[model samples]
Target: MKRIESEQNASIKQWKKLYTRKERDKLGQYIIEGPHLIEEAMNHNVQIAHLIIEESYQMPHDWEQLRLDPWVVSKKIMGILSDTEHPQGVLAICRMSSKELQVKAGGKYLLVDGVQDPGNLGTIIRTADAAGLDGIVLGEGTVDVYNSKVLRSTQGSLFHLPVVKGNLQDWIAACRQEQVPVFVSALKGAESLHDVQSSGTFALVVGNEGSGVRMEIMESADQLVYIPMFGNAESLNVAVAAGIMLYELQKNRK
Candidate 1:
């Protein structure tokens, strides 16, 4: 195995570019860390560019026989490339192609509005997968779906569904075209989520943790609903609210 000991190694430099959104966009490649995400990508049959591993990290049984690991890297170099606290010891740079995210809600769709927390976004992606969402749309100002922390949070589940990035107005209009009810989570004039029955084909618009959905988007929603807050605490995390909404939506789906 070719070892990359020098920090200035060309491949190392290329992988470092994964940290930047610009570079990731330019290359159409994003970095994925840990065994879980790698396995997830594989299970999803997404194209794999390079599989990098440290000498100490054992390659998975499936990976060992594959054409992966074009090169071996050092712990230090792997550390430099990884973004996690406890690095997965293995990493892969994957090429992502558009999954053709559809706004027409056939089953369920999650529309995120400027959610910045990586963990929150990741959890939401995982939740969406569990809920059997048809797709997810990231409105402008929303966190990058490929962000490292968000990627880690998803634990490879992001591969399960179609995720698209665009403005809310345009996508919501498309949903309306498909006759899907739009449900917006709002703090005011919002009906109790339990009181309102979820439609089979529906879209859930989740706002930012601090600021709710943009006024324009909220105004366009067919119905605005709120999760009943029994406790005295303030609103729930954007992701938590998303999970609840998905739970209810999925419960009604089946």
Candidate 2:
């Protein structure tokens, strides 16, 4: 019911800061666009700092009865909030969930190494959720999971899983401490995916788009494995490769 028409409104200025990762870190919040992502955040009980809607657009029927009233903004202001070519006219400011990753005995985990593509990272997260993995550890060079493109590509799966950032070496050591075998996906001097059997409790490391896993991490892995490529194509997209490896690792467990 509250309307903000001025582009220079103090609240609007503060909201714009969310567009950058630094500001998001400083403010402890990020923006999620469209109805689906908003619904996902709401369902997860993530703290909704603000529910912002374009002034010309009517609030969704389901949202009107919510305990929080939507803050209406001018269409010009909505344009500033939107990152996409076609604005969804609805967006939310959501607090980041506290990091929930801890290596446990007999747990299945995915370790990502410097995966820079937002879409690929998002797909990998969705795949991990579908595979029912315990959690995902994102190494230093990985893209921010909160990146807008990555968020959109996740299709709400990110909210369904526990994802946390960590140092790859520390994570590897923790897994080893728990007796979980760590397997690195590599292109050379590695066993085939078919030849590598999961130990039930294991950690799978997927790497960068072009460079693959870092040499140091690969060397530290309990074993290195590669997907068999019989077709003309040289390699698989990092995301596709991840999906295959994760599913195969769990295939015989049941």
Candidate 3:
């Protein structure tokens, strides 16, 4: 195991760059903080580029059994590497999956359109995973899935399935070509959510927090569906609405 005490250390400097999306994309790597996320990544067979631990942390015996060789850093340096208020004393640098998933016919999919809030995007991704969807396609303007808050909100579900950054319009075209009905969430000129029947395979398109799905994307959707609002609430949170729709579509499969 190596020890890195100085914040000026070259390795430390490179690790810190992972905090930015641009750097993460350029390097094709991201940091997963804490034990649970690390474990989830391990279970998913994610490649660990490197492991960083607080110098004072007593390395867990079970962790030692793994193939990882950790680099110990001072707590002060850990704070610099961590985005969280409280550093968990453990973080892993992991390579992003190089494999891009092609949208397949007869598979369930969630298409995220322009959802800017990290928490909402994370929850939606997690919900999609829970619903047994094949994968999620993140369209233009969606929050960066690798952002710390978004990653935390996902609770490691991102590693469980194929989550691809993509163009929604192109995906819509692909879905149409594959005969995978694409449903968009819209208020006006949309069918009631309860009324649409799913063929056990389709793509659901959800959009921005305030504006909802873009008009161009909506026009391309095989259909537009809306959740009925009963109370004085203006509308459901995008995450909540996504959860409702995802499961409802799953039920249609049954």
Ranking by lDDT: 2, 3, 1
lDDT by residue (tens digit), candidate 2, 86-202: 999998998998958889999999999999999999999999999898999999899999888999999988898899998999999999999999999999999988877777888
lDDT of 1 by residue, 181-252 (tens): 899999899898887776678899998878989999999999999899899977998888999987886566
Write down the worst ten-residue block by lDDT for model 3: 245-254
Candidates in order, TM-scores: namely 0.95, 0.95, 0.96
Prediction 1 TM-score vs. true:
0.95
**Over 4 Å off in model 3, which ranges?**
none
Q: Write the per-residue lDDT of candidate 3 for residues 83-174, one digit (tens) a residue.
A: 89999999999998865777778988999999999999999989999999898999999988888889999999999999999998898888
Off by over 4 Å in 2: 252-254
What residue runs in model 1 are displaced by over 4 Å at the alpha carbon?
252-254
- Better TM-score candidate (1, 3): 3
List per-prediction Cα lDDT, in the order shown: 0.86, 0.91, 0.90
